[model samples]
Target chain A: MARHLQDTIYKYVTMCLSGVALALIFIIIGVLIDSSYPALVVYGSKFFTSITWNAELTGSICYTSGIAHMCGATFGVLVYLTGTLLSSGIALLIGAPAAVGLAIVLAEIAPRRLASPISFVMELMAGIPSVIYGFWGILVLVPYLKSTLEVGLSHSLSSVPIFSGAVFSAGLLASGLILALMITPIIASISRDAMRQTPEGLKEAGRALGLTDWEITYKVVLPYARTSIIGSIALGLGRALGETMAVALVCGGASNFLPKTFFYPINTMAAFIVFQLDAAFTDPSGMSISVLAEMALLLMAITMIVNVVARLLVRRGFVSRPENLIQV
Target chain B: MEPDREPTNSVQLQDSFSFEGPVRPRNYTRRKALNLFVKGLLIVAAVLVLYPVVDILYLFAYKGLQVISISRLIETTAGAASFNPHAAGGLANAILGTLFIVGLSSMIAVPLGVFGGVYLAEFSNDNRFSSIVRFFADVLAGVPSIILGYVGFLVLVLRFNLGYSALGAAIVLSVLMFPYTVRATELALKRVPNGIKEGALALGSSKTTIINRLSLKFALPGILTGILLSLSISVGETAPLLYTAGFSDYINWTACCHTQIGYLTYVVFTFYTIPTTNAIDLSYLATFLLILIVLVINIVARVGLRRLSRDLESRI
Candidate 1:
């Protein structure tokens, strides 16, 4: 009787413990759908396509119960959604190659004694909070970009459409710069692991053939770590896509139009929600709150797909070794 | 220099690639120049990685250090004049609020994360349900922190009427922290040698006894590292706490689920936007404190993981 009782208790406890993981999925879906139901019902698919976000219908009633006012016909997230993609895509473009080079330098080129300390510093960089990055972007990066880089670019690249617009201190470019800096550590660390796992035999074989050190690294090591490097870039992409506070602070909070140029101010979906959420709670219109929730749902779906795909890519050949899993 | 030792398989390829006449005395100077160029690029990359860390530290030290004092550490934001960086008030409430929320969250998350990890690692035998659980855990971890805050706003704040409290904020932070804990603990448990578990089983030990008594003890250091990593993540969070914790000017020692609480990230997010020198200084101070907490946590995690690996190496 005692043994049976103990077995039952153990089974119950473990099952319940594992249930927590499953519960998270349900909660995310439930909250998003339940809170955003009114928008789902009212806007249907137009919420994704329409660009206007005029949620300030002074006397309209919200479909969600218990709200006196709400967004009338013109609510949508097309602009913010585009802003999120534009910044993250540009950030990945700028960050991935630099990160790969840094990873190679740390893993193969730098002397062993110097390499470990640099690796530690990169990890420390990763640990800094997103808000702090935003703060730095505002005070330091923005001014520098405005007074130096943007001015230089405007003068040199004025014929280019993207650089023709009047440069703002904070905008898509600023957001992307901050994101590039933020994601460098994640990409570098993961790719370093990939590089470290390359067989020593191949490197030695290259060396024996009178190949230069750089040539051995380029031809033998990099090709071997290609998939892992791609996986790390994907991992970095996921982080950049979902980054909130830092992007929010630097993206200049402009929600009006899709950004036509890199220097034009824009607002990401995450930033829109963060900037508007406080007013959302107190606003007479419940529609704005639900619309934000719907935006959250969209953001959640995207990040989930990116992360899951990235993990699968990272896990494909390294199934037996769990240590290679990307920490992000 | 010895062409005679060339492998038969590579002789034809080498002949085609090399200069036609007597292997043209391998250009030593060109190889040296290429190597130097590559080394220069590597040095540039290293500098690129180090530049931001130095920038943030230098700026914070110059700006944030000037205004920080004992009062700033201990006094509540209440009763202080707004926009005055030199006000007699401090972030004592925000400090306490952060500690309270993070502490309660760790208490809830650590046990649940550990048990879930054990299930994934020790039990389940890679069954379908456990696989699903693991998949969702990964998915949950990838969900943006702001989205989690929105969820918290809907469920805890609006639906449950929890009223922007530390309890609600902690719950949101736990959800954010949960996957890291699970992954870390699971990885740690996997690190325990299979031989040890088999030895225990042969001695007539129950599976529970082996897991709780033997395996957990062995994996404790890695698990602790994971917990600290999660805590650091929780400490640095801003979005989730935005709507869930709200903000209070004063410390509220009321029920955990009732009072709106202040956090350092909140100050960093809100204060710098204000146009006052004092406000900007306060934001910088809060930013410095936040960076300090995360740096310490990350350092501890790294040291703990290194020690755990060393322990594993010794056992081998």
Candidate 2:
């Protein structure tokens, strides 16, 4: 009876504690929904489709009215969302092949002694803070791209819309490159694990059939690890989409319209929130704050959607291993 | 001729064609070229992935070390002359503020996360409520941290009028760190020996006592690692703090819940933008310090976990 009572108490306590941790998510969503209601009522779907983000400089007076009344500045998130997708897409395109190649090296090609150190370095890179990447993007990478890469690309691929605009130091291309660098380690680590799981017997069978090493790897090993590799790519995509400070630093922060060229200045949803939220609070206008909240909600929605899809692809019905082996 | 080459077996082979010829040589040249190509690709990829790490570390060390000093570590930030290179101030306030805010948040997050992990690992079965919590926690773990800052802005800063308090920032950070702690603790607890718990239960020890006395002791190292890791993450976070803590030039200690706080990451984010020598120097210094602290924590957590596992194995 004493043990039973103790068990009951323990269960009750743990349940309550876990509930508190879980309820935080609900609290966040509740707060976002409640505060962003005004934006929802005013902008509706237009908030997402519109590309204008106007902020009145002289708006310290009208705290009661929405931002439109306080300043002539309009708030739309279409451009930011487009920039987010474009950069993330470019990041994935560049990162995926490089990650796969690195994984192949680690799993199949490199000497065991060399593989471990390289893997360690990559993992450490993963742990470096995003702000550091942003700082680097603003300083070293932007200049290099402007002076070298962009000039070269414009000369060769100038017929394409993405490569047409005059290349600036900080723009979509810079963010894409920074994001690619940031996510390469992630995709490589996951893909390496997945490739490592490929059965040795399969490789031996391919070899016995008189296949070359590259053929075996490309045909047998890669095909076997395809699902998990795709899963890793999805994970990288989710990371690229939501990464803030780094993207913000290099994305050029222009929210007027969708970027027409790779060199066009752009802003992402997260970056938009970073700058606008500060401005909104600095002024404390009702409309401005609500609009920021609305943006936050949209940003949350996009991140959550990407996360869910990625998790589904990576983890759902695939509980054979830990999906999030690399902590953010 | 040897017995194996004798003609007796050839006539019994039903008169099949018996002349053997040299087999065609395998295309070694093409295969070798392919191998070389693959090797080149792998080398290029490795270089691509590693160049940034080397570049960033080198730049940070070269730039940040020149500005770092004992006085800089202990002195207050310059109030008005923050951007002035000749100002007589340092990062004492930011360092202390980081410790205070992260320390407080750790206090809240560690206990809840640890206990929740224990519940998930020990008490909760694959029930609907537990599964739901597990799912949401997984999603929450992936939630872009900036969104957490926004939510904190709404609920804590705007609604509650807790304007830019360290407490508010801590709350947001706690939320951000919560999923990670729970994951680490749960994983650690799962690693604990089930026999120990069973033996305690057989001795008439209650579930709570078994967990508290037996399981928790074994899992302590792992739990500590998780907590330390979370603390590092909190220290490095800038966006959420920007929304909740708000930046302050001077450290405000007396009113922990009501006043703004400054941190290393905030300095790194805000100061790097201004085109001033002192501001840039401060940014670099803060970046170096933050990275150093985080890397140290990561090394300790990994090495400690390794040693703990080894010790556990020996005891077993």
TM-score (chain B) for model 1? 0.86
Candidate 1 ranges with C-alpha deviation above 4 Å: A1-8, A62-73, A316-326, B1-36, B81-86, B308-316
Q: Taking the tens digit of each residue's C-alpha lDDT, what string does model 2 give over A1-328?
A: 8779888888878878777756887887788888888777766787787898876656644423343335455678889889989999999988888888888888888889999888767766777888888998887999999999999999999998778868877989899989988888878877777777788999999877667788888999988888778877887888888788888888888868778888888898888788886577555456778878777777778777877776665533332212134343
- Top candidate (DockQ): 1
Model 1, position A132, has a per-residue lDDT of 87
lDDT of 2 by residue, B14-80 (tens): 4776754433225656776887898788888878778888899889888889988887787777652
RMSD of each: 3.9, 4.8
**What fraction of native interface contacts is shared by candidate 1?**
0.57
Give candidate 1's TM-score.
Answer: 0.92
What is the Å distance of residue B234 in model 2 from its true position?
1.8
The per-residue C-alpha lDDT of model 1 at residue B87 equals 56
